[model samples]
Target: MGESTAPILRVNQLNKQFGTGCRQCNEVGSRQLDKNYCTACGTVHACQQISFDLYPGEVLGIVGESGSGKSTLMRCLYFDQEVTNGEAFLTPYKDGSSNLFEESSQQQRYIRNHLMGKVYQNPVMGLRMDFSSIGNIAEKMIAAGNRHVAAMESRGSELLEKVHIPLHRMKEAPKNFSGGMQQRVQIAKAMSNNPPILLLDEVTTGLDLSVQANVLDLIKHLQRELNISIVLVSHDLGVIRMLADRTMVMLDGQIVEQGLTDQILEDPQHAYTQQLVHSML
Candidate 1:
């Protein structure tokens, strides 16, 4: 759980806006609209002035309702979206000297391949539906320069087994699997490279309660076994409580509060956080 130490990843003044900065946008920004959408210039501030540190083996949970920019933050960090402003430093990348946002495309590709793993809320976004479960896991391993077919198969099989996916189903395509199974395949693929950090965006969002419990338990087990830092984003406090060592509460495009998971859940200080905690009661 990292306890107390320097962070493995650091983000400073991160911002992501989907529009040009114009006088109209300035006026709208000055008005401080509660929603991210701007009525004047039609810009969307998906993330604004976000900053955080994620220590090794620590699970940092980001919780917010739909359109709250939690997913956007994950996308930006994973290089799925470009950052409008700010710097991100990953300890293993370039010795944490250069901001990851400023890296070359090739460097970013290498970083994503070897250093970080991501599992999106939608399996469609994370898995290649046409690819077999083993093939999907192999794709990430190949990206990290794995070449031996036998070794890849062994590693892939091990990961799938860890996630409770049947060995007989390893050659089956994810499209043929159930939603929970597809998500498990995604998790197995994300862990293929044994990355130091993992980003999970609502990984249990649409599952049945029983299925969700299984997936969540798998995640907790994997975290302990892998000792990887994780940034978990979910609207469900229960999920956060089950997985996160620390939690951050977000609203609109900004973080309203952050602290130890228990502190944030049990003694919510912000009004929105209080409302969220109350609803869970």
Candidate 2:
């Protein structure tokens, strides 16, 4: 076995705020002024002084209630949104390391298309509702320059099997599946290119408890076998415990507490974390 090492991702002093100038940031007022409060209609601080690392094959869960900017942070890491300041890095399980923000736009696009994948909170949004599940996955594969359509088709089937979705449903539109099934299909699509890192945003939020358990199990199993790093964002501590090796607790755009999974779970530090734990119990 390979010796355990450092994080696959490292971020330091990451600061991102919406809008332009202080006057604009302030016009919106103090209610929105994050501690790192920017100077305009600073809709959200998004993230600030957010330093952390993610190891290869480790699941790093981001826990924050709604409006805490977890999604925005995730988007910034993937370059979906602009990051105002600091370092962001990712060393994939397969490729040379890269500074996500420092890279050229072409390089960033290449990484987004070929090495990283993201799943949205709502499955419906992750896929093209008009296309069949197979079409959706294959279309993405082809767009990413998977030259052989046959190989991609075969791979898509394998993915479907892994997710326990029936092969026959491949040609069927995702609009027909139950919410849980749709989620599984989206997982299959996201994994189509075999990315080394995945962003799972509230993947199980809407499912029933039983289905949620199964989805969590599936995510864990896939992570182990694929040797992929994952950033799982969830407000649910139970979900975090099920999949994360480490946890980061965020409140209003800042990471208030972060550490190994057990440490955070057994003895949380921040008052917000304490309150969250109390609410859960």
Best by TM-score: 1
Segments in model 2 whose C-alpha atoms lie over 4 Å from true places = 1-4, 23-43, 93-98
Instruction: Give the Cα lDDT of each candidate.
Output: 0.92, 0.82
lDDT of 2 at 274: 89
**Which tens-of-lDDT digit does each residue in 149-233 have in candidate 2?**
7898899899989999999888999999888888888888888888888999999998999998888889889998999889999
Deviation from native of the Cα of residue 145 in model 1, angstroms: 1.4
- In model 1, the number of clashes is 0
Work out the TM-score per prediction: 0.96, 0.90
Candidate 1, overall lDDT? 0.92
